[model samples]
Target: MSHRQYAVTHTDIEKLNARLLSISLSRDERDWQSVFHTHHFTELFFVVSGEGNFLFREKLYHIKTGDLVIIPPYMEHTEQSIPDTPLEYYVIGVDGISFQPAGEQTCVQVFCNVSNKALVEEIFSQMLYEMRNPAYGSDKICQDLLEILILRIIRSQHVIPVPIASTYMTKECARIKEYLDSNYSEPITLDTLTDLTHMNKYYMAHSFAKYTGKSPIQYLNDRRMQAACTLLRDTDHSISAISASVGFSSQSYFTQAFRKKYGMTPIRYRQSQAGDDAANGS
Candidate 1:
């Protein structure tokens, strides 16, 4: 979460990075042991047939047959199967590809996705065909298939900021989103965001609203609420502590914001969620 990290604004179609991504249709059983790890590259897992709960950071993401989960770079996560059925799945390790910007300078981007089952099947079929044929044009076909896979994932998910119609627009908006996500604990202002993107405050506000479906302040508040939701569901922190952690200047303001968003106070929401989890034996 560096402030000055390069943003991914465009997709690389030609010269896509190739790697030996392996898939497994069977595996042995295991216990409720922790398997926490992080990787520099992105990883994707599709459960073709299985049932499990994936521990993503502090939240539990329930996964099952045909479910896909994309683990972003440096995500600390693990999965545990809850059913006795043998696990079967597709796992892809993304490789970074080099791309030249409009200035002719090169940068690398690691391709990854949150989840898209249709695209996964299409790409898997194409890859299997290429592997079986190994004809003269198989390499090119595989490359195109990989591009399709990346595009499908990008189109279907909202986590990563993919290029829109314009590259500059994407870059500017990505800078704003990245700043909000990385520095949600700090107070931000229109002047600060405008300075970061080098755009006029008025124009930046309007354009951001048009593209992202939210004004800059609204987006920041929504991000804060997202963090609050995670804390309420996973942590033993008090309501005031969670509010402070998510950058709300005062407890009253945080309570009002949480009530407005979730139709309940933070303490009530946390209690309800905890009761549900307990009832489910989680």
Candidate 2:
């Protein structure tokens, strides 16, 4: 008997230092509202079914089933569904790493018409299942799955994984930014942020401004303005109602802020958007 033996060689794999933060599946039956928001960690958005548009960096990208979008930290984005088709998807939040596609300077990437749809869907489904039903080693399993998912994405999309350095100021500023994103409609003040973060108000303000190039209140107002623009374009809500809905106590104040930001009154801005939509036959 003639037999040939092949020697096996060890391969070194780079360690991936990352943490799985959260995972959730969204469906149309829940009637969820989409709002412009930002996170301090990377977000993996997978379209499971239906059609919609993803708003990122003030541009809208059409998305449908089997699309995958990777949004880096501190990127403002939102997703809205087509009225008839609606949207069903999964959003997974991961920290400590971001992706940069080959030859691209930006960290955000979108892979449309993913060839391995079934495999991707199965992985997300398993991750969701493990999250909802936790037993021994479930956390480990989820972490491993997250790594596998990221590896698959890198391999298929030709993206590079860049490690993020978590620092004290980064964490503190991220906490403050997240709070502003989530509670923009609520009454907020420096005292509120101080209570929430346990940091001195002055130092927190300075650090946050250094991190985001805007004060905490400026960021909050920006968030509110983004939400107001969305409402003005999509809903028939009056200016006063929209103002209140977006955390402005008075319509006049909201209009004044809106004019300062857009160089036009709120009504004029809405009319301009309407005209553009009509011109495009949308």
Q: Tens digit of lDDT per residue, candidate 1, span 119-215?
A: 5766766766676668998867766676676656545643333222321235687678678778987988899899899999999998777544579
Clash pairs, model 1 backbone: none
- Tens digits of per-residue lDDT for model 2 on 134-214? 999999999999999988887788888877652223777888888888899999999999999899999999988865668
* TM-score to native of every candidate shown: 0.56, 0.62
> Which residue runs of candidate 1 sit more than 4 Å off their true CA positions?
1-47, 52-63, 67-123, 128-135, 143-169
Extract clashing residue pairs from model 2.
none
Deviation of model 2 at 171, angstroms: 5.3
